[model samples]
Target: MDNISRRGLLTGVGALLAAGSLGVSTASARSLALPASKRFKMSATTNEFFRHKPLWGPRVMQSFAFDTPNNRLFAGQLRSETPENSGDLTLSQLDFSGNVLGHMYLTGFGHAVSIGAEAVGSTSYIWTETDADTTNGRGRQITRFPWQNGKTLTSASVTKWKPVSGASVYTPAVDQRFGRLGVRHARSDGMYINVYSLAAARTGDFSTVLASFKQPALTAGIDFQGWALYGSYCYFWEGEAYPGEPDETKATSKLWCYDINAGVLVDSFLTLAGKSLTYREPEGMAVYGSTDGTARLYFGFASGEPGDRRANLFYRNTLV
Candidate 1:
């Protein structure tokens, strides 16, 4: 069980300082010019949220993001503990040291495949899948809501957005550097990623999009685990769990880099970053935009047995 704490009264000043460091005004309404995706190499690893069980289902963590403004991380897992044929979710809030400080429940929200966390001036918001489908319990729309500790929110309580008309199963990603938000969605035609201004996206005005591109079809070999949109590059995380007899050498994950601006598949690499963990299954992805120009691409994994499943977060930080 995690201990939840109330914030201090002096958050306003901290929030403003955080916003300045994040390169934003009260609202992130402007875009910043950054360099192109370097097709960077996976350098080192940081074990964030290692072997931590979530509040709901003790389930495998599916997605996560860094709440830079508040200096915390928000992680989510599917709520399949009950036989409701539901898409409810449980989100855990953690400090940098992997200590869970709080939690919130999301009803009728999809498998939490990917999540985006944004905050300004002490108020934090979560961006993820919502309006779940009854059949498979996947999300039909992307939604946003305030981060409330110890609170359970339903899909009806928040507004949902459909980036592409008639598109379903939407998972969102946020890059605060340029105030960008992107969603990977499936439509009748095919799967696509649409990027928009975070400000415009919040107000339900998706017009004047920044970038729209088709995601590369997954090859037969790679298992699709998670994805993230950082700057002009969209990254895909792929890896399967180990078989009954676990082999660390065989337990490997891959990161695929697709340059959205160039409209090309930049490069990809099969990684054994956390190969030592048992049942090492790759899960969610998020990008941490640092002011130093090193955009850290972070991802998560599920390890251990079913009843004792835990979340492990790793990142590829330095560019080659």
Candidate 2:
């Protein structure tokens, strides 16, 4: 398939290209039979992402989302290794096996903590954090823009939308099966997740929130990693990459579950899958609704050296 170029796209349809948001539609959200007992397990065998490498920027895969309609995976990463360029972000287009297909750049975007991917007809739009805070390289505004391969689009060049005001930081993720978009923010009191219909969020009208709940706390020193929202359940990361080589001494990454409806913590488990990876560090989490109508919760890990890193993705397609 030829990559469509929208480097000149300037609103919801033209500029940001609200792919799925152009029309009001709904798909009944389905649960993957995640344990309501808070005892989530990963008994399913794991599969790696075929050493998926980004076409540009730091090879670290910070966050990713599935372009279900296109059978593709979109990943987010920092564009540079220097501190002065930390605010820049990059998007890599890839196949489900984790092989690079194409790429684009989003300069002055946030830390690339999370990104939303939507495919409409022949166009694919990306939802991400923009308007870098400068101080810490975090995004203060959420924005959507069409994916223009080989093009560099700046925050000021695109339309910026802060779904919630007074939040110190903002990041976004998309759930294809549920047809929802979630923007997680950090406020004075605590972090919170605000979910909205994909149709409403794309148009900048968040007056009606589908779900609002406080984010679960993280381990003291664990870096806040990737996240995803499916139905009313929230899954987040709780582990960091090992410094050098990941070996027998390396720690297993932890994935936790939060029930947004009941507003409580539900499940937590350490995954030993991919324990053999080098420099094993947990990064992104995405719930992919396969073409066969089955839901798979994908968790990613970063490996290899700094300049030559590879993304190792694994998923649980069955209940544990």
Best by lDDT: 1
Model 2 misplaced stretches (Cα beyond 4 Å): 1-44, 52-55, 81-86, 247-252, 290-292
Candidate 2's TM-score? 0.82
Leading candidate by TM-score? 1
Q: Score every model by TM-score.
A: 0.83, 0.82
Q: How much RMSD separates candidate 1 from the native structure?
A: 11.4
Per-residue alpha-carbon lDDT of candidate 2 for residues 1-320, written as tens digits (9 for 90 to 100): 00111111101112122221111212212112322322224445665555545445556788888877777788887775545435687788887666777888877887777888877766888899998877767788999888887888888899888877777578898977667898887765556678888988888888877777656444443455678877667787746667665565546577766666555555666677677677777778887774324677888888777677778788766543
Model 1 misses residue 296 by how many Å? 1.6
Span of 10 residues, lowest total lDDT, candidate 2: 1-10
Compared with the true structure, the alpha-carbon lDDT of candidate 1 equals 0.69
Candidate 1: residue pairs that collide: none
- The TM-score obtained by model 1 is 0.83
